[model samples]
Target: MASAALGEELKCSICLYFYADPVTMRCCGHNFCRVCIDHVLNTQDLESRVYSCPGCSIKFQERPALQKNVTLGNMVEKFLSTHRDGAVISCTYCVDSPVPAVRSCLLCEASLCDKHLRVHSKSPEHVLNDPSTSLEKRKCSVHKEFLKYYCTKDAICICMSCRLDGKHRGHRVEILAKASENKKKKLRNVLEKLVTKREKTEVRVRSVEERRRKSQEKASGEAERVTALFIDIRRRLDDLEKRILREISRQEEKLSLSSSDVIQRLEIKKEELSRKMRHIEELCNMADPLTVLQDPDTGDLCDPEVERGDEDIEENGVGDQDLGQISRISHSLADIIRGVALYVQDPADTLLDVNTAGNNLLISDDLKTATWTETCQNHRQTAKRFLNYHQVMSRRGYISGRHYWDVEMSKLGVCRVGMCYPSIDREGDKSVIGDNTKSWCLFGGQGYDNQCSVKHNNNQIRLPHQISSNRVRICLDYEAGQLSFYELCDPIRHLHTFTATFTEPLHAALWVCGGSIKILGRSSYEEP
Candidate 1:
């Protein structure tokens, strides 16, 4: 009975089914599946600017704007998942007589019905997954066998034969089920972090949206408050021309000329916020465990696929938009909001390592801060450890797109803050940041004390002014080959910009020339 009511609420009035490619009309705030609305209004006649809602029949002379409702789409997906009447995972084993799958065995690589399961096997020796899954993916391609074990070294699944004598013979192997569970756990942590980020972003967007709404309301209130001004003007005009002018209409027309531009700009901003947060929210709500783990770029050494990216919204275009309106609205909105605006951003999740840290480097327990200690700690000798250089690479890395991070240092200390390639030498000349082709940094005046310098490929450009600040921020634009440095301040003062044609992935590099420095936690900055 409740489902039926939900079905009614979820359905589009035109097509009479739960919304698909759903869009909400601005006129009546009623949702209609995009196709249904298009068919109803006639796509050919969209330019006519005359349409009405099917539910409320509210007439709109301007063909009221449609906003894609991703949340509503997600709700529909969730509803369908529970119902399963529309799309069902049929038993793969039953070709001639297909039925809804009861159990999907990963070993046999097939979905089976209750009748098939009763006759197929005597005992359940295989792990099972949800019906809405392809069992064939669980088998090894080369061996044509069930992937029973996981090879940690190669980061691939292997069959029993491969585990015993094949390429993964000597590699550390764990049971497939156990390894999958571990991966799921890792995915859970990642999902939890992403959910927190999504929630925060949603809140920020909501705040800005509310602010925009209130701003529009306040503007409307201002028009309402100034009735006497319009009435006084109208009274004089009435006396001179003997014209009976509608005071409210006359005032709103003048006000709306400016307000329309502001409202349009705010709508565009709202859409941008929607576009940025939808992808994240979709990833966060993913139900497939394997898909969740595999979707994100984990910065694995062997195969460095930079798959996960939410850094920028390249999907939106500034083309064909009114430049004058944007410029005017920006100034107006800035004045209204007191110069505070939201920026699209991603927080760097870097953790310092005891093993990766040099013997002279002192790392904090939380791994957020690092310092140089005179006495070397008793640490194992590894190839990953730096020899002569006082440097550390961030655990998180960027293979593509833009990323920003800030480093806070002692006021009088010399330091290097930027990024380096993974192949940067751990020993010799190339080991030190800014001394080789693989590294780039904003050095604390290599030749002159207190002067700020930019370094890349063994070349240094010393700035004329001193960078007297405890906090320094670095912005990396990988594809564009622009590494920008800015002094962390109220206005974010630009210190220097380095241009380079980078060919590889980059990790956050911090080289303390002397004294101590700390990498601020995510809490310190605003993330969009």
Candidate 2:
């Protein structure tokens, strides 16, 4: 009942699918598949069995209630039982026999009933096979007999008569062993080769994708920054204009006030001068001429007042000459006003001539393409597999902690796989397999010591043994800002003879110089 109600939600949160070997977190009471939890923990570098819930921050130290839900399991079992049997068919052993039920023998040339089949196996004359169910059991195409043995030279199964014929004569033969086993070996070899090629191609795709993503992001960021800068520039320009405008306004106001004062003083002086000139005219026109011409008995005292008035008139005229300089100042103010008015315009209309367009800010095509090409080429050279290089594309940069040339053969044909970095010793050049050390830097692998190996174009690194058919992955370290090589290995999955070559990081040669980095190898889980 609970299973039905929570059916959809019960799916493991990690894989977002039906649970496979479910396990529960103790603290938070959350459940997840075993593989999913293990993968997360392993990749995250947790040493203890204790883990925190992904959905919640609760920590758990001990295993929790992790019993499988039998209700869900039963439903899957029932569904498979009903549909799977449709593929089975009648046994081939009973096709041509007279008996109601016939059983085939491993060696005997005849079919038998259940009773006879038991008796035949007990008899020393024939060998009996364990019965198994299959779909449309095969009968010999040439002889209409069940196949019992395989001919290695002909690479086919045959009946007793077919074995003696010229087509299979003298061929190495054995009991027709498990057909699935033979098929698996052939398929594994093909799958391995295909995977190697795919890995190479993927390297290119990954590099290009990463570069394009970053390039676009960087360009977008720069555009935003430029926009912000323009806003600041406009503000600064406005402030400068405002300061100059204020200064001009103040100067004009000062000139206006000074001009008014000069004009008022000139008018007052003109009125005073006009009054003096009128008095002089009246003296000339009147009978007072007798008094004007007569000097008193005391000549020293006569017309002393008139002398004083004349002297005052001379002083006022001199003041008028000094006041004339005000007109020159007014002319300077007019010039400034004309210049300020001409410069004041729209702020938006101003065009900044800053040059910012260039290709240096972008991720270059040549760098990305070269990195991808090198990665693909290395996979071909190291894995001893031919790949369609054109199919590959560059992807984002990758860093590998492990030196790859150390793939071990002992772990092949297994389910679990691992990758590790090799180590370097004081005698660095002597530790490598090849004599040249200029082209490569050996960081270190898990087991290698005191050996140097050289890698050149078209050179192949021989594996110690064969590898199983599995998904092959290759990684490179591109932090050096230039193309370099990395050796890749997974000791658990293969004993392959080849070392995978990986491309180094994308770089800006126009800005950054090429430099070498030491390679490091350990388990693929090691820090890159």
Q: Model 1 — TM-score against the truth? A: 0.36
Best by TM-score: 1
**Candidate 2: segments with Cα more than 4 A from true spot:** 1-137, 149-156, 166-175, 178-183, 186-228, 262-528
> For model 2, what is the error of residue 148's alpha carbon versus the real structure, in angstroms, after optimal superposition?
3.7
Q: Which candidate number has the best lDDT?
A: 1
Please provide, for model 2 over 1-528, each residue's C-alpha lDDT reduced to its tens digit, 9 standing for 90 to 100. 333344445567788865665666554566777668656654333345465667675665543434445555554443233222323222345566333323445445444556666555576545444333321244467776666678777778787777787377777887766655787889999979986887687567657766876777777885676577446545644655665566666666766666676667667867866876676566567785576566343244346785676566455434322233444444334333221211211111111111110111122233221111122223213221112211111122135332221212111111111221122111233322222221222112222221222232314344433333222222223332222222222212211222444343311111111111111211122231
Each candidate: what lDDT?
0.69, 0.40
* Cand. 2 TM to true fold: 0.31
Q: What is the Å distance of residue 504 in model 2 from its true position? A: 32
Please estimate how well model 2 matches the true structure, expressed as its whole-model Cα lDDT.
Answer: 0.40
lDDT of 1 at 167: 82
Q: Which ten-residue region of model 1 has the weakest summed lDDT?
A: 306-315
lDDT of each residue in 241-311, candidate 1, tens digit only: 32123333454565666566656665776786577468657767988877757755332423433222211
> Model 2 misses residue 397 by how many Å?
27
